[model samples]
Target: MEHEMRAEYEEGVEPGPDAEVKNWHMVRRDGIKAMCGRMLSESAATQPADRWGEPEGEPFCFLCGAVYLREVP
Candidate 1:
């Protein structure tokens, strides 16, 4: 089954001076996996249960409580 992806602005941290704030768009399954992988790789600590499940499917961001998933284009 396919999934739905959603993103929201992180709190406190404003977009960088040169950062161009844009709407978060839906990406593919592989793309979502890659994105999550990169995020995990950057973090030194293990992801929380809310962010990373045992099987590593779509997870919600604890910081913003936003859910992430693969979205159909």
Candidate 2:
């Protein structure tokens, strides 16, 4: 199940000198778009590299330290 990621940038959300900083904004600037309870399944050999939409890199979940493999449904 692949999801098309979209980010809505807010003007004062980057912890600027203003007080109206929104918390979440496509926060996963990089890495998996959805967790799907399938965290850290990256190193598994069942899937090959050519299938990845993004070039392979060290993408890890910043909050939980999980790596996800892309498997579009």
Candidate 3:
């Protein structure tokens, strides 16, 4: 069975001009934990499944992507 992927944003306040930038992490569709085994907080922000890859200029979690590529078909 193939596991569905979901994107959840972890917002952080930076010191640069871009005060708030969202770093999206890939997680299993049915759970809040990311593919890299990081448990997302209850307040984490989520997007529609269609918008998973639409975050331009924002980086994805490398560990999550790596695990997804290796484990999810």
Candidate 4:
């Protein structure tokens, strides 16, 4: 799947930051907006659905290792 996906980008777009960025972005973005458009489209899709539900457990930042759980009121 990864190879095929890469081929699609290689043949369909220019070889530069835009293509690579979009390719990497799509890989990480998952199915959030694979069918609609570009990263901007994914950003727009995030607004309403961003708070659909609470995390069942604590969520951790992959980079800083910070943990966030549901804040109790």
Clashes of each: 0, 0, 0, 0
What is candidate 3's lDDT per residue for 19-60, written digit by digit as tens? 343455666665678777876654455544344446542466
Model 1 gets an lDDT of 0.30
Model 1 bad stretches (over 4 Å) = 13-73
Candidate 4 clashing pairs, residues 3+ apart or interchain: none
lDDT of 2: 0.27
* Model 4 lDDT tens row, 1-73: 2200111133345544344322221222234323213223322212121221334111312221111122111
Candidate 1 lDDT, 1-73, residue by residue in tens: 3332333224433444442222232222323332333221111112232323323323344332233423212
- lDDT of model 1 at position 12: 39
Pairs with backbone N, CA or C atoms under 3 Å apart (clashes), candidate 2: none
lDDT of each: 0.30, 0.27, 0.55, 0.24
**Which regions of candidate 2 fall more than 4 Å away from where they truly are?**
12-73
Candidate 1 pairs with clashing backbones: none
Rank the candidate models, highest TM-score first: 3, 1, 2, 4
TM-score per model over all chains = 0.19, 0.19, 0.54, 0.15
Better of 1 and 2 by lDDT: 1
Better of 2 and 3 by TM-score: 3
